[model samples]
Target: MQQSLSRGSSPLALLMRGVSRLNLYLAGFSAFVLLAATAAVFCEILSRLFFGKSLVWVVELSGYSLLYMTFLGAPYLLEKNRHVAIDIVTEHLPPRLQMPLAFLVALFGAAICLYAAWYGLAVTLDQFQYGSRETTVLAPRSYLLTWVFPLGMVLLSIQFVAQAVACLKR
Candidate 1:
């Protein structure tokens, strides 16, 4: 399990633990979302070819599913060290040099993701206040989708922070 710097008897630790669990659960849901989206796309193609008609909703729904899947899985992936990496320089670096570099990079990632989370929260709030709706045919409230951006960003930022903490603990 991913753990916060504060292990026990602290509210922050509790919150972090909850966030870790949330990442896991959401990641699982993300997998389901991907499967459903794929099935929807396949059905749409079949409908177009066989019935000579299109499933208009599939395109928009699939787009949303893609967005959700990307965001939802990110935190868990980062926490588990399964996220993408380009280690050309790092792999070649001496072991002593790599630790500080990795920690710094993790800190940088945390800072950037945190800033994005803050901006995403602002946009989400604006959408909520203005009652914005997507201009798409579905006309769903913009918040329905906008909320996920901040949620994902927040989760990712926390995961990055956790990674940095782990690096330091090493």
Candidate 2:
């Protein structure tokens, strides 16, 4: 009985640990993105003003980096349940109502993210199929840049499912 109990609890504990670690990883990645963006911006300024030339590539690259950073950070935010909520209604609701409302919200959010991932994947494939490339310097495939959206959203959707499960179990 004791062994069974421990084994049964272990999976949940492991899942929780993984989720916590994922949040830390996401936060770290976000910080790195921020630093990269800052550096890129600084370099852009230096190249444009001091060198009397344009660092047009830096602007484009940094813009994409910013977008990636925002998406990558989203899953971490979801895990922490740190997203902004109006709370006007939730704060006033009873615990019972709150629980159901939270579940429904999570379900809806997960569904939306799942759909986004599907659509993003399709769009990325299309770009890849067409050999689309950026108009600016480097001219890397546009599909590579577009991939971040689907991947990040999928991860976020998974995180929300985990959160919803935890909430229901509680």
Candidate 3:
């Protein structure tokens, strides 16, 4: 039988469950964003064909939507272990070493994600403080898009930490 972390009232287990739920919600939101982007593209194409003109904001909005979708979905993908992996070498290792190796790998991934989150947050805050805007006709605030990067990275880092904990438990 699978162990039930939810049955225990441990803070780490609770945190893991909370992060998992958040990731699921983010993934759903990302899917919605992707659909919106698809609709925008379709509308752009139809407008171009029928009216010989395209909406000025469609392309930019679509691009932003794609970016948001990627970032928002990343944590859920990581939590579900859906990210690409090359496990050929690791699979050959002895069974006893597998959990350690996985833990090490998760730790490394968490470190990278944390660094990315920190850097993204710094850039996002700078853009927000400076009132930076994209140099496009839409002229959207740069921070609006940049904030997603840090948010995703932070979530990814949390997922990695949860994975690392699971590896340790194993």
Candidate 4:
């Protein structure tokens, strides 16, 4: 029997290394956003409790932080397969079918993410076309930042495909 043993990627190692660096950068950015969100929440809580003044923008910033963190971390999370899953059925499945089933689930999840990303991109574009802005103070360009959703989802989709390929090879 000829066994095809998967080995190191000498040809694409450079590309993989670059991608790893990018993922690290994204993870760092997400961590920074999370820290900023925590600080904003803390300051908002303190201000509201002690001075009877609220940081209205804090709420919006917190929302942005949440979105950034979620989107930025998605690719890395998928690469690691760290998302929570109900493994009872998968675990009981025979060894031969496990990879296929997992790949199907991942493909389904990728499709859903892709659809959400498409809508997000469309909405963001519409906002850009209309020059949409928040009603509150600071009035940041809401639509420009909205493109992050589609960009992140695209990265996640690629990660899902790579993961599926890895599983099939195993």
On lDDT, the candidate that comes out on top is 1
Residues 1-170 of candidate 4 have per-residue lDDT tens digits of 00121235564555555555676688789999999999999999999999999998898888888889988877766665676668999899999899899889778777887888888899999999999997767788878568778878877776665566666768
Per-residue CA lDDT of candidate 2, range 1-170, in tens? 01222234577556656655765786688789889889988988888788888877787888888878877788877776676667799889998898878778888888999999999999999999999998878788999889989978887787767756656866
How far in Å is the alpha carbon of 52 misplaced in model 2?
2.7
**What TM-score does model 1 achieve against the real structure?**
0.91
The estimated TM-scores of all candidates read 0.91, 0.82, 0.92, 0.83
TM-score of 3: 0.92
Can you write out model 1's per-residue Cα lDDT over 77-170, one digit (the tens) per residue? Answer: 9878899999999989999999899889988998888898899899889999999999998999998897888888888888777777788888
Instruction: Give lDDT: candidate 2, residue 123.
Output: 96
Runs of candidate 3 with Cα error greater than 4 angstroms are 1-7
lDDT of 4 at 95: 91
lDDT, model 4: 0.76
How do the residues 1-170 of candidate 3 rate in per-residue lDDT, one tens digit apiece?
01344347788667667877888898999999999888989998999999999798988898899889999999988877788889999999999998899999988998999999999999999999999999998999999999999999999888777778777767
Candidate 4's displacement at residue 46, Å, is 2.4
Q: What are the clash counts of all predictions, listed in order?
A: 0, 0, 0, 0
Regions more than 4 Å wrong, model 1: 1-13
Q: Comparing 1 and 4 by lDDT, which wins?
A: 1
